[model samples]
Target: MTGADEALARDALRCGELTILGRIRSASNTTFLCEAAWSDRIVHCVYKPVAGEQPLWDFPDGTLAGREVGSYLVSAALGWNIVPHTIIREGPAGPGMLQLWVDQPGDTDDTEPDGPDLVDICPPGSVPPGYLSVLRAYDYAGNDVTLVHADDPRLRRMAVFDVIVNNADRKGGHILAGVDGRVYGVDHGVSLHVQDKLRTVLWGWAGKPIDDETLESIADLGEQLAGPLAEQLREHITPAEVAALRRRVRTLLAEPVMPGPDRHRPIPWPAF
Candidate 1:
């Protein structure tokens, strides 16, 4: 979206009146598709109220919504526009995360071919020409399959972003190809933890040397985290978590290489 459009969307999310349209039943926590209206503008947004957050053993209760907003703040600092315009506000279910909805290609028109999913599963030894293989496995029918993600630079930037945020659930479904020709990641309520909880499906770039331009962006983000960004993150995550984020950035800058999968639970279950 253009800068003005994004500004408007952010304003709507921060101050608009929210009307819940329906529940997203597939979500583990309570999620609603809603309309946020402000002045003469109305935008569709996803609302996940703090009151509806599911208790998790690893994450503290009632903090997931704030983490979502925190993820957006880091994304903005990176200047990558990887996350949608998101904010915290009081909704029908109480204080929660309200994110501007991104329309995926073909979401509103079936005739338009759907955008290519950055991550996918294909038959063994059949990875796409421009894609990179992540893992080899078997499907329910006993057929061999390979997990893969595109080698696109936009997706690579997202992979690096996930590393910086310590994202614990970078599922394939969370990588969105917006109709506006931008890539976006969503469902970041499980990120920004103090420990190394980097679970994801975008392991195609693992072990590769990061490009210089992206490294510059990473360096810029590192500087921000030392300043206002650290304070902004502390509003959502703990002080220790913010400190951990700075450490991750510093480590990446020193190494300048993508990390490989963890020995245990490297990728999330139900990879798609």
Candidate 2:
């Protein structure tokens, strides 16, 4: 989507104009399920304006411009369809980023067969069953290394995207399986770090060898970084940030295999 598309998706009213779809109460922040108009399409989004601390981290002090840029990079880099559709105006809390709403999987009305029991890590009185879940889970700060790949290329792409961003809260709950067997990833506010803060359960592939296809894609991404991809991200992020992302891409491409969590792994506790 062009910057114009991003601009059109914005709603000046922020929280007021958007429809309050629901609320997600997790160990970290209290997110409002929101929807706003973007041309003919209605975008689904989660507005987490620094509610509290639990997942060990929250957005920066004010509007997280980095998230908008990171989401754009992930969506553009890999063919994985991440949500961040638009960046809405913010009040004192934070800028509301509009994301594409993905329909939850396993709905009776849909056709895809069910997979294993994906746990809903919502608080006791919070989550209702049948709602879609993000691929990452809450409170996964201290959990053992668990990867999100299920042999699906799309899912694998999502994992690579998270790795590049140095995501810290990729809990099992954040991975939402759509009714069409497509998984959707969300909750990427705290990313693009210079530290090795990789803390997720997607460790099944850890210590395992990286496949040639993914390796090739990583190489291609590296090349793209110095080309058009870099240009695209320049609109939302600084050139230095783009350069840093390119460095990460190069590291992933040059490395023989992806790294797994070791003694230095950050405690998986939420920072609410």
Per-candidate clashes come to 0, 33
**For model 2, how does the per-residue alpha-carbon lDDT over 1-272 read when each residue is reduced to its tens digit?**
35564455444223334666777765245567776654465655656553333343433333344454566565656655553443445523455454555567444465655543343344433433433322344445654322233544555566677777777767666677765466666776666555566676455455556678877767777777778877776665556656777788788877856666684653244322
lDDT of 1 by residue, 1-272 (tens): 77798788878888999999999997889999999999888999999998899889999833999899899999999899999988898999899999999998667777555444689888888787899899999978988999889999889999999999999999998999888989999999999888899999999888999889988988999989889888888888899888898999999999999999965998888776
TM-score computed on alpha carbons, candidate 1: 0.96
- For candidate 2, the per-residue lDDT at 43 reads 54
* TM-score, cand. 2: 0.66
lDDT of 1 at 111: 59
lDDT of each: 0.89, 0.57
User: What pairs collide in candidate 1?
Assistant: none
Model 1, poorest ten-residue lDDT window? 108-117
In candidate 1, stretches whose alpha carbon ends up further than 4 angstroms from where it belongs are 112-116
